[model samples]
Target: MSNISAAIPPVRWGILATGKIAALFAADLALVEDAELAAVGSRSIESARRFADTHSSGARAYGSYAELAADPDVDVVYVATPHGRHVEDVMTCFEAGKAVLCEKALTLNADDGSTLIEEARHRGVFFAEAMWMRCNPNIRKIQDMVAAGSCGTVGQVRAELGFVAKPDIARLWDPELGASSLLDVGIYPLTFTNLILGEPTHIVAAGIKSDRGIDVSGGATLTYTSGAVASIAWTQMAWSDNRAAVSGDGGRIEIAPRFHETTGFSHARNWELDEFAEPVLGRGYAHEIIEVNECLRAGRTESALLPLDGTLEIMRQIDEIRLQIG
Candidate 1:
């Protein structure tokens, strides 16, 4: 945990890309007291100005991402571009000596993810993957409880996340954009399972791919050395329950529907059930912003809650899954 001091100035953020996710992140930045949207960047000048006008009246708008990276007032850049462009965009921020909070699935594969991490290390700049679910208060609480034996010797895990994505969405169907149901939604269940089971000793996966050679639905079973097993699934072609559970000999923990952004969960043990709830700020993105702010103030280069090595491991897992399914 970073030692946060009230004396530290607010961390200035630069948004690189005016996409839907980027807009949501910009809105959530207002909920963090120690974070400020200092700039907005887009390929088009008009788009940049529009986003800045809507999200932050005082923020500067840049027609090019390089201009935003070069801004002296910007302390960190949020790489909100598509996963396919992460390596290039993040490198731009690092070149400017600015910290970064990149969107999840850090890149198309672990190799590119490692490349960005190496560059960040060489530049001595703070860098973190924006895996917001790991930073959620309720998720963290569940992790703590499980670690403290509240869940009692976990043995099995099951999780799934899916939604009916429209066919017209280019980013969802375009192979060049790095579109895949696994990369978009499967990552959540995979991360959730890994959090409970650690690294898997054996992985068996199968999936359905689109005609464009992108995975649209998939499932994987992971076996651990502890004899524990996890079954996870994801899809972009249908709406799933989006619930997750961890079961052990002692008890079971049930996360609410849409587990990734869930604000509450329940624990059942010995015929007694207990409910737990936590406050989620601004659609649950504020927690990550708060984390980044704290790390910046404490001069930390990586977030403990969302470690870089963990991100790399998850990327490698995704790589293996892709190879198996492809």
Candidate 2:
């Protein structure tokens, strides 16, 4: 940490949207001792004011994202806009010389994601995808254990996430918003598998598309060079168990329901079972906030836990899956 970093006790945050996900992140930001929800921006001043009043009384509200990005008091801006608008929103922040933490599925496609990341690097601005699950303490613990051979020679991984999204939710059904179950819910399971098994050598996928041509439900089987296999699924048409598990020759680790945000898991081996648990801070979003704060304070450009390369890789994988299913 620099002297300036040490001088500032709390890192200031600016939220770029006032949607549900943005609200969830703002609420979680309150839980971090070293973070401050300093500002919020929306296309409408009323919406921004409402969000500020509801989430943080002292936070400033901006009528436009450009104004928020231009605020000198804000050390970093969280881009919570829709996936389709990520490139434009993120570029605005970058141009203003502000660090950014954008929501997952960084962009609608790998090419756009690459462009944004390259621009961030060229500008020497800090950037990260808000893949909060990768920042979850419990999930990190699982990664360490698996790397330590706790799940020896892992052979198979199974994961799924889904919810019944109605038509009223335009973002979930509108192709113009870059809506797709794969980009929304499916990214979780795909990321989970990649974290454990590395990149896949082959992928076979099939999906059911809505009238607007967006995938509403899908499943993919990924095969790795080590002969490990992963079966992952996602849907926006119905509810799913939202569970995940990893099996190997030695044992199996099962994450509880809503696995991406799970606080615990069970490891079974030799007719015995052991459990591991960790505290999830404020709906599991605080961890990522903390990570960004630490990185900013330390003058780091990207997170090692959720690296830009990793995010780009996932986007490429999704692109491939979409191509196959289409």
lDDT of each: 0.93, 0.94
How does candidate 1 score on lDDT? 0.93
List the candidates' TM-scores in order.
0.97, 0.97
Candidate 2 stretches with Cα past 4 Å from truth are: 1-7
Angstrom error at residue 32, model 2: 0.4
lDDT per residue (tens digit) for residues 156-241 in model 1 = 99999999999888888999999989999999999999888889998999999999899999999999999999999999999999
Cα lDDT tens digits, model 2, 1-326, are: 11234666789899999999999999899888888889999999999999999998789999999999999999999999889899999999999999999998899999999999999999998999999999999899999988888888999999999999987988888898889999999999999999999999999999999888999999999999999999999999889999999999989999998999999999998799999999998899999999999998899999998799999999999999999989
Pull out the clashing pairs in model 2.
Answer: none
Tell me the spans in candidate 1 whose CA falls farther than 4 Å from its real position.
1-7
